[model samples]
Target: MNILIFGYGNPGRGDDALGPELVAAIQAENIPGIECQDDMQLQVEHVTDLTGRDAILFIDADASCVAPFHFSEISAEKDDSYTSHAMTPHALLHAFHTVYGKDAPPAFLMRIRGYQFELGEALSSDASENLEAASLFIRNLCKSPYAESWRSLHRG
Candidate 1:
């Protein structure tokens, strides 16, 4: 399947760099049928990126998720972040639907567990371990990029 793996976070902040770090690793693999992107944050303009992909995986660092990571399928919905400059994955899906006049392709969010999101700090040792675990999980998921297969791996 044609897949887009979009990872977003502020690399300048500790642990928040997980998303971008993971994206960099995946990009280096040169996996076929997979396109990877990294950004400081998600924006409404990103709706364009959703077009023509069979599936999308949005990755971010989450302060509240369980250790290692959390994963789940997401649907279009207008939430409070819809009005902000930085949009959430759900808000981005909503925009995709509103702009394209159809439901977005199967989309999922993988929130890697993080701590110490302070500016100018490097990734914490604990968060680094979590990132390693999440990295393995994503690599396996990419091998079978089907919606149902992805859903079966969901954890929170």
Candidate 2:
């Protein structure tokens, strides 16, 4: 199945690098039928990247999420972020539907637990471990790119 793995975050900020870091790792695997993209943050323009994909997965670091990580399917919904420079995954999906006149491909989110988001700081040891766990889980997900397979593995 075709899939897009989109990760967004500021790499210079400590744990905020989780998203881009994970995207880089997955890109290195060179899996077929998977397209990977990373950016400092999500934006309305990102909706263009959602076209012609069977499924999409968004990854980011979340300070408030449970340790290690949290995963769940996300639906499209217009929100406050829609008017801002930085948009949420849901906002991006909403934009996709608005622009394309059709619902976006099934989407899921993985929020890797993070701490220490200070500028210029390296990833914390705990966050590094969490990244490892998330990486392993993503490798498995890539093995079965179907939405049904992903939903069954949801943690949220």
List TM-score per model, in order. 0.98, 0.98
Error of 2 at 116 (Å): 0.6
lDDT by residue (tens digit), candidate 1, 47-154:
999999999999999999999899899999899897887999999999999999999999999999999999999999999999999899999998998887898887
Off by over 4 Å in 1: none
Residue lDDT tens for model 2, 8-56: 9999999999999999999999999999999999999899999999999
Candidate 1 minimal-lDDT segment of 10 residues: 147-156
lDDT of the candidates, in the order given: 0.93, 0.95
User: Could you say which candidate leads in TM-score?
Assistant: 2
**List of clashing residue pairs for candidate 2:** none
Quote the positional error of residue 155 for candidate 1 in Å.
1.4
CA deviation > 4 Å runs, candidate 2: none
Model 1: what TM-score? 0.98
